[model samples]
Target: MITRRDFMKFVGGGFASAMALGGYAFAFEPLARLNVTRYALTPPGWTPGLKLRVVALADIHACEPWVSASRIASICRQANDLGGDITVLLGDYATGMNFVTRYIHSSEWSKALAILQAPLGVHAVMGNHDWWEDKTAQRNGGGTTFAHRALSDVGINVYSNRAIRLEKDGRGFWLAGLEDQRALIAGKKWKRKHIQGLDDLDGTLAQVGDSDPVILLAHEPDIFPRVPTRVALTLSGHTHGGQVRFLGHSPMVPSRFGDRYAYGHVIEDDRTLIISGGLGCSIGPIRFGVPPEIVVVDLG
Candidate 1:
């Protein structure tokens, strides 16, 4: 027979123990790696003579519990195995400021990033997280001037409103990257800002010639409405496709237009957009229906 006080003490102790266990389970539970998703998008003027395999990975918020260097390397290795003609990385390479300056600075993270390689070259753009956290400063050893040199050093072409052309099998296509719309909006008032506008697309396209096929690399899918029809296809990732989805439905999305821009491929008019669910978590540590992804887009 226990006194009331003793019973209450026992209950509190059990509750505390359960909470501790729960916390550990939530943090250290084995991360479930996901299968790569493949899709085909045939844009207008896409030459039948060109058969290209392009692999795109995005929104890898490489933080602890969800994404580590080893995990990112594994994903890269798998992509490499797929024998893609080119690999494109949409942004959010590092989780945030604290994670980049702290956890991701470890040797494992560096080693993981080193594993990312592709034949035609790996191109990328900055995500809202990368731009907002002042990684440009981290790149220059303390000054916000597009400091993604770390990624560049590891063979990634970090493009901001820029274009590069890839020639394959005697045919060529233009790959262009735009600064994230959020970053552009946030830095609108500043002069000499890193952010750029959709107007820059005209100049980027000019370099590749108007008739050439062009694939635009942008981080946020919301920018879809702003892209010109001259762009054959656009690839983005920033939604995480509602990381913790249920019953094949996303419970929440952060876009201003609600669920209209939830996830996967959305084509309007002549422009084809592929939105990757991304390869890591954001805002939380769990992913249910929305598993991470490596998108392979076949262009023929």
Candidate 2:
């Protein structure tokens, strides 16, 4: 019954199965290494009165197999160490699909929020993922509300089409957050219908005055063109900078404006936009060239 030929076939099949499992394990291994790349932005007309160093982390997509609580804690620690006056979390915190529940159960997200500390404060906004996740719970009326409450408990100020004025060293600036474009485009029946209307940057700036530099925190970088002239700088993180960019270039960019807005800073007219590559991956768990980042803007 134990012929040499049959035994060989059995061993070969077992080896193939083992190899397949090993490959799967290896594919997801890099996600465990949570490293946040840091970048600095200094605008030309910035005044030295504030000397504010703002640290921004966006597109966290906190879920299993990608970003973990331990990893998020480490990122928070690093931001604290940098000693920035303010820390801004751009949106897409959850995957908002089948993985939405996974984000809900993420202990790392809660832990990460607890560790976030800044001299001024921490602020955030919702992204496309937030809408997608909430839409799933339209009938139950619990999904989006739960996410909002969870983030609030963590002390992150989620600004949806709103602005908060901040004063430092006798100098003042405005921080504004806009509703995600995806939600607006999805129309009235969208589950996250509460997140209607785009942010009125001009209206918000009117309250603060034109002289004061306004900093906008929008989830999707595509909103850059819509930003008003008074907005000196805008921070965003929806693209994940083409998560799997090849040879220093992304395969495809979903933005209407094309590849120029794929990643990093872009100066158009008098306004400046900085897009973070983000701290997590989407679709596949691999990050070949596009690494996660934490952007630092020195306004002096």
The model with the greatest TM-score is 1
lDDT over C-alpha atoms for residue 47 of model 1: 73
Models, CA RMSD each: 6.0, 6.3
Q: Which residue runs of candidate 2 sit more than 4 Å off their true CA positions?
A: 1-36, 96-108, 136-144, 184-203
- Model 2 compared with the native: what TM-score? 0.78
lDDT of 2 by residue, 92-180 (tens): 77764343225545334755767889879988787776655565544453234344566788777877678878888888888888766
Error of 1 at 260 (Å): 1.5
Q: Number of clashing residue pairs in every model?
A: 2, 1
User: TM-score for every candidate vs. truth?
Assistant: 0.79, 0.78
lDDT of 1 at 53: 89
